[model samples]
Target: MNPYLEIHPEVQQALAAGKPVLALESTIIAHGMPYPQNVQTALEVEAVVREAGAIPATMAILNGKCCVGLSQQQIEHLGQAKEVWKVSLVDMPYVISQQLDGATTVAATMRLAAMAGIRVFVTGEIGGVHRGAQTTMDISADLTEMGQTSVAVVSAGVKSILGIGLTLEYLETKGIPVVTFGQDEFPSFYSRHSGFGSPLRLDSAHDIASLLHTKWQLGLNGAVLVANPIPEPFEVPAPQMEWYITQALHAAAQQHIKGKAVTPFLLKYIAEHSKGESLEANIALIKHNARLGAAVALAYRQF
Candidate 1:
């Protein structure tokens, strides 16, 4: 295992100086959205971290090597190129074996973030149990990674499209903590609340940093789930988004969409059905998480 990870020059200096560095995933750039906008959002989120006084480390696997931070050209390539694998922790070996271009998912990015010594990651939302999981057993690898990785995942809570309530319960069963930022209610990605109470809430990034530091000191492994809500002004009405989600999900089921294809399919349906509002909300929330994650990373660095 040649773990000779390559760090972008700026990220190298930042890490050397013990500066705050936030780990970002590449799936959003490659598999989550269409081109041009994908790359544009990627760059914009990086800029948000930079502006927030922390360095950004966008993780991906390019040409069989783990890239802890991407170059401008690499980002451009990821956006324009097709066939990028949505590499999870288990898929790393397969991706490397095939020497293929791959975008790291939350699970893959968290593993790489730990390997690169990053403490925090920001994304739209973590994946979880799919709807009606009792029979299908469909679950995201992210749940398992959270049990093993020593990193904090910041998001606008779980996407309401999934089994949000069940996902939280699953995390609890795995002994992973689900804490919300400044609120006790778990956010529902597009909405402010998932209609359920969060297990814990911490208002400040400093406080969240304390939780991470204390957990690591106690020798407990796994990551923290920070449910940072989307900005209110940008949030779509839950009722409205729900209408869009239901319609899209129904379309996906009618098409027999399964496995990895489900998310993209549903997202496309929602995007078109909502007149592109869904993607707009997705982009807004992601940028918001980047800023929050960067702040938390900065706080942790000071500690």
Candidate 2:
């Protein structure tokens, strides 16, 4: 009942009843995909979470209030809304103060999820150290939030446009646990392989839940990253995806797109150049993560 927060009744009940609840980000609806598809995917992901035995709480900002779960109408409006702010930690205050609509990035989502006592979050992928970040000092706020928050994030992986090696190293320095699900090799968001071995791998939701429980029980702080690979049929081969990413990155550079604009710009470029295949892969991976997130939340409830 805080003035700045609004929790949907279902999500509130789940929290009060100790039932499993999975938190989802809103940037995927507002800035991550095209209109109808964004709305469609949002609905589908919610359905997947419910089927997997949890309630879905898709977080966003509406009229300056942080909303923990969006209704169907709100989801549609968000997907079609104009000039919605892509909100991260730094943008939260401004968006709220201005009474503007805002889509929650991974960082913003994690922060709000922690505020609402929701421990499991699902998203398409995470932002990471941008390529050439050594020169630009442009690492994403998502990494910083991971170091400070307690939510467990289930994502496809780091967005492939980023410097994966550097991002992983930064995570190591911050002591964030990155655990790959089912595979020993970490995934690149659009593809099943990143050619980099994961530092840790847990094959099932129960195992992931156990790890999370133990970490918190031992008084460990910060988030747990669960990298879930896209299903094989939807995965673009690593080599092919790398080529597409290169083209998209170059295009972003040519357009002088940086900061908050970089990811959506790069994703749009890849989606267009790849004849919509990349978008398909993106949607598929989100659904996959939603399922895993729900399972992990359910299992964690028992801990």
User: Cα RMSD to native, each candidate?
Assistant: 1.2, 0.8
TM-score of 1: 0.97
Tens-digit lDDT string for candidate 1 (1-303)? 235477788888988889999999999999888888999999999999999999999999999888988988999999988788989988899998777889999999998888888999999999999888999999999999999999999999887789988999999998898899988789999888678899999999999999999999899999999999988887878888888888888888898999888887887788778777878989999999998999999899766
Alpha-carbon runs more than 4 Å astray in model 2: none
Question: What local lDDT score does residue 291 receive in model 1, on the 0 to 100 scale?
Answer: 89
Q: Itemize residue pairs with steric clashes in candidate 1.
A: none
What tens-digit string does per-residue lDDT give for candidate 2 at 136-248? 99999999999989999999999998988898999998889999999889999888899889989999899999999998898889999999999999998989988998898
Per-prediction TM-score: 0.97, 0.99
